[model samples]
Target: MCGFWRRYFFLKTLRGLRVLAYSPVTRPTIVPFDDFVLQEMMYAYKHPDTIKTDDEWIRWIFRLRRRERRHALEFVEGWSGTRIAIAGTTPWLASCLVGIIWSAARGNIQTAFTVAGFILTSSTVILAVLAIISSVESSNRAVT
Candidate 1:
C-alpha cells in the first residue's frame, strides 16, 4: 500500500508538471536541462526517415544564402550611390567652407574651432543620408 501510494503521488506530480510546462502563463521561462542536441543530430543523420529531409534542408540553406547575398549586394549598391553623390558634392562644399574660413581667419586669425564645428555638422548629415539610403535599399522601399 505504501509503495502504491508513493507511485500514485509521483505520477500525479509529473502530470501536474506536464500541464504547467505547456501552459502559456505558467510555462517555465528557461530550459532546465540540456537536450543533447548533438546526440539527436547524430541519430537523425544515421537514421534516414522515409520522408527525406536532405533535399529540404539543402533548399532551405540555398534560400538563406541567396537572401544574404541579396542583402550584401543591396548594401554595396546603396553605399556606392551615396558615396558617389557625396564625392561629387563635397568639392564644392569644401571650397565654400574654405572661403568662409578664410574670411574668419582674416577676422580673428582663429578659424580652427569654426572649421571643426562645420566639419562635424556636415559629417553628421552625410552619415544620416548614408544610413537612410542603406535602410531604404535593404527594405526595397521608395522614398516619396
Candidate 2:
C-alpha cells in the first residue's frame, strides 16, 4: 500500500515536470496543481473514512489553492533571479520540494511537515543568497 502511494506520487511529479517542459505557459498552474494533488492523495490515504464528507474534500481543494499561491511566488522569483543576473535557485528548491512530496506520499505527517518546512526555509535562504550575490556584482560593476 505504501509503496503504491509512493510510486503514484513519483509518477505525478514526473508528469508535472513533463508538462512544464512541454508547455511553459501553464507551468505556474501545473506545478502547484501537482503539489496539491499529491497532498490530497496523501491525505486521502491517511484518512480514507472521511472520503465521503464534503468538508473533508473541500479542505483538500484548499490545499490546491495554497499550492497555486506558492507556485506563483516561485515562478516570479525564478523570473526575477534570471533577469537580475542572480544565480538560479531552481535546482535546489526543486529537489527540496520533491523530497517534501515524497515524504507526504509515505503518509508520514511529521516527516512531511519537517520536509515541507525545510524546503520552504531553504528556498528562501537560497533566494536571499542569490540576491546578495547579485547586489555585490552590481556594486562591483558600478565601481569598475
**C-alpha TM-scores of all predictions:** 0.26, 0.32
Candidate 1 at 46: error in angstroms?
Answer: 52
Give a tens-digit lDDT track for model 2, residues 71-131. 2211111223233332334545665677678776896767776776677677767657755
How many residue pairs clash per model? 0, 0
lDDT, model 2: 0.48
Best by lDDT: 2
lDDT for each candidate structure: 0.44, 0.48
Compute the lDDT of residue 9 as modeled in candidate 1.
19
Give the runs in model 1 whose Cα sits over 4 Å from its true position.
1-78, 81-105, 111-116, 141-144
Pairs that clash in candidate 1: none
Number of the top-ranking candidate, with TM-score as the measure = 2
